[model samples]
Target: MTTSVSAIVIIVLALTALGYILGRQRALAVSDREKTKLHSLPGYYGQTVALYVAVPAFLLLGVWLFVQPIAIESQISSDIPQSIVDQSGAKSLVMADVRRIANGLDLLVGSGGFTETDLANMRADFSNVRSRLASVGVALGSDVQPAVFEAAKSYRNIGKAGSLIRNIAVLVTALALGAWSWFRITPRMRARNTSETFIKSLLMGSSLIAILTTLGIIGSLLFESIHFFRIYPARDFFFSATWNPQFRGGSDLGILPLLWGTLYVSFVALALAVPLGLMIAIYLAEYAGSSLRSFAKPAIEMLAGIPTIVYGLFALITVGPFIRDWIAQPTGLGSSSSSVMTAGLVMGIMLIPFISSLSDDIINAVPQSMRDGSYGLGATQSETIRKVIMPAALPGIVGAFLLAASRAIGETMIVVMGAGASARLSVNPFEAMTTVTVKIVSQLTGDTEFASPETLVAFALGLTLFVFTLGLNIIALYIVRKYREQYE
Candidate 1:
């Protein structure tokens, strides 16, 4: 089954690639005008067709793949004797054991221990099932008794005979569309419309990947969170912000302080990363010579490549104590190894690469013509970069900053390792503070009971993080769309 499915996947890939190439060639070949020739290139047309073929086919295969085993097993279980199947916990165990035996190509005497006869019978059964499924699938284009196979593959075979047909509906559609488009590409054909539509859809589809991935992540989190919320009240989780999600009953799991910690640490981290990163961007883009830029840019980017856990360990071993003794101890703050300042500062350093790299890219993207114009107008280099370049890059900078902020808010390792797990709603940077992420890590790891408030609280934290970041990204994108300068 796996090998057969793998072959199907390979065929889909090959077909998609072929469709794409053919569509693009057809578009290019059909175009008549030179300048106002195409609103989009041939590649877009090809990609659009490829998407049409791949998405539907893949979805069908995935659905069929998921349901086939379940339906088969369910049917097999039903047919087995009641004496063998009737018992508490027996059904699950029996199903598991049966699946194992089948998977191993082993068989049992009516769900009992395997015999030589059982093995032969199992082989026969497998072969029979495979042939029946293959027959049903041969020409079945769309509907499968979803109770049996969810969604059938697109290739419809001949209906007259019960056995099989090589359904090539997708291939046929591709060929037909390709041929029609090719034939229509005359001096009068509006190639631009066809090309532009294809490009627009391809862009939209690419953009949807981020949205869908975000949705999928949040959806999974929401389901788990809903389960959590069922076991606990929403009000208590949100308002009781002082979180002590120890395995104790009636512990305070207030979200407010956890939220407070997240905000405070993020504020400090941003305060540290943003200004420093901007300065680094300025130094590299304006002040630094070519040699300096070469050495510095990658070296700075390498900061991002460092593992967060390594940074976490650094915070634990070095930064925590160094701060405790140098600032926290002398300033009358508690001498705790884990403090908000420690987490915040380390997090800020981690974010430096993110901010600097994005800022650098945006800065470089600002047209050098703008700089020459500024220079011609008697503006100093610094003045040009400050006024013209930075302003032009503002939208991109804002987007990058928001993305970084999201990262900071979502960061767990540094906070878990460095920030004290006490969910205190304190503004004092020297004092220990714990963020929502810290609580999530603490609660979810180790042996956990799903029903307990401690465990359930993690999902609530996740949802809050999700909503907050989602809102920020949405707003940031809106700003970029409306106000950001486009240098054509």
Candidate 2:
């Protein structure tokens, strides 16, 4: 099958290349081998031919590959008995075995281990089909049922037919389109215009894919959240202060504790990062010499390149214990190594580069004329920066801060290792608490039924986090637009 698919791809490519050469030669011939006599460049005619050949063929091939398996499965599923499905506890599981058996049979016949005649005549009770398949690298969970074996045979037959039909259809379409475009090439044809139109359509399609993908993600989250709300009351999910989820039943699935932890940790991180990062940005942009700034800026930005997991390890092994021993323990606030302050402080360190880099760029973007104008008024350097530069760059600086805040809010690894997974509504930063992301992970982990509230709650948590971050972005955009209007 792989060989056949590869052959199809190579053949399509070869045809496309052939169309390009033929189309170019035909354009030159029709123009009496004079370039200026043609309506467009000879290459444009060739490109137009190539696009017509490849685009429709590949599109048809793609659609066929995606839809054929689904059609085949739907048809074969009806042949499996209800008893087999009941024994597996899921129809999907039975279908999974059927697919495995079908692939194994294909492999067995390909390797000359069993003839198709022998496969058809073999009885499940006497043949030990499972062991034969296992030898060929296909492991079944249990003995193959006779009905499942029959279904597998049908699946393979249908798949083979679909593949043959698909390849023929695709090749026919490509040849038809390629020939049509090839013969349409004339000395007066607007090849350049048609080619440019195709390019523009391609660009538009790329943009539409991005927009549609975002919409698809939001749609999925919204649908799953709606399902969750139907099972659990919206009022309790929103207003209740507890955070507990149990698969057995009767769990207190509240948002308040997780929300509090998220906000509190983010606030601490921002409180530490914003002032320090802003100061670093100011120093680098205004005070530091070229040599010092060159070295210092890269060193600070390097922090952003480090993985979050590495930072989490640093928090767990180094920062957490230090905070517990030096601050929380000595101050009698809390004794736990995994505390909100530990995660926040470590996350703030990780976020420093993000805030500093963005703020520095924003500050530097402020027109130097603004500083000159301030200095011309007899103001000192500090006065010029305080009154002129900061205000000019305030909108962008706020945007950088909000972006950092969103990063802190959505963080999971540092919170998991440093702040622990005990969701609680508390004002004390020295105590351990968990955020929404951590709970979302915990709820969705392990093999659980998606129909249960416990698993569905992860989607609800994700939707809430999405909304919160989206609001932050909107606020940032509004501020940027408003300030740009005033400044301009």
Candidate 3:
């Protein structure tokens, strides 16, 4: 099926390319091979023909591919015996087995290891179908039931027919559209206008897709969070100080502890990152010489390129232990190597490049006339920077800090490795703590049902995090807009 789909794609592309060439030639021929005799350029006519050939066919292909499995599964699911569903306790799981069996049979037949007739006649009791499939690299969890085998065979047959029909339909559509568009080509057809309209539609479609994708994500989170809140009390979730989740039952699914840990770690991170990063940006943007600035800027930005996991490891191995031994242990703050301070410091290091780069660009964007005007008024370079430059760039700098804050709030790897997954409400930064992201990961990690409040709480946590970050972004945007007019 994959090979067949690839073949269809290649054929569609070939037809599109052919349509372009033929459409160009037809336009030239109709204009008596004179370039200026046509209403638009020859390329625009070719593009129009190519779009006609490719767009509808690809759209049809995409829709067919998306809808086919859903339609087939719905049909097959209805046919599954109620007794099997009762035993399995989940129709989705049973369907999963059916898919695996169908895929195995397809592989077996494709590899010439078994004929369709052999597969149809084979009995699960006598033939050891699981082992046969295992030989073909399709491992099943259990022995195949007779009913399931029959369903698998039906699934394979229907899938094959669907693929065949899909291929034929897509090819026919492409060829027909290509021919129609080719015949429509003329010396005065305004091909440029038609092509430009298609391009505009394509750009609009790309923007719509991005917008729709964001809405889809928010909708999923909102729906699942609603489901979670229905199961768990919203008051307890929001106001309770404890953070505990049990898989069995009766869990105290609170947000306060996790929220505290998130804010604490992020605060520490930003506290360290903002001052140092701002200084670095000031030096790079205002004070550093050209040679030193080029080298220092890239070297500082290199911190951003390092993987978060690598930073996590650094926190876990080097920074965590160092803090535990030198600072926490000596001061009697906490003994745990994985502490909030450890994660925060490492995260701060990771965030330095983000803040510095953004702040540098923002400060540089401050007009030189402001600096010259300040200097003309008997101000030193330092006074000019403080009195004129920083104020002018304050809005953009605020936005950069808010962006870095968002990044810190969403960090997971460093928290996992450095801050240890212990959710507690405390003022001490030297203790092990867990953030919303870490808890989100832990809650959804194991084999748990989505219907369970324990699993659903992850969505709630995610939605809360989303809303918090969204608020931050809104504030940043408002500040930038308001102050931007003043600066301009």
* Winning candidate number (lDDT): 3
Clash counts per candidate, in order, are 8, 0, 0
lDDT of 1 at 229: 77
- What lDDT would each prediction earn against the true structure? 0.71, 0.90, 0.91
Write down the lDDT that model 1 would get. Answer: 0.71
lDDT of 2 by residue, 98-186 (tens): 89889998998898868989878876652588778877998876777889888998898889889999999989999999999999989
TM-scores for the candidates: 0.63, 0.87, 0.93
Task: Give the candidate number with the greatest TM-score.
Answer: 3
User: Could you give candidate 3's per-residue lDDT for residues 1-488 as a string of tens digits?
Assistant: 89989999999999999999999989999899555589999999999999999999999999999999999999999999998877776687788888998999889888986898988787766258878888899987766777878888889899999999999999999999889999988888999999999989988988999999999999999999999999999999999987778777889989999999999999999999999999999999999999999899999999999999999999999999999999999999999999999999999999999999999999998888788889999999999999889988999999999989999999999999999999999999999999999999998877666578999999999999999999999998888888963444
The C-alpha stretches of model 2 lying farther than 4 A from their native spots are 1-14, 33-36, 76-80, 83-164, 485-488
- Rank by lDDT (best first): 3, 2, 1
RMSD of each: 10.5, 3.4, 2.3
Two-way lDDT contest, 2 vs 3, winner: 3
Question: Model 2: clashing residue pairs?
Answer: none
lDDT of 1 by residue, 377-407 (tens): 9999889987999999889888888889999
* Worst-scoring 10-residue span by lDDT in model 2: 479-488
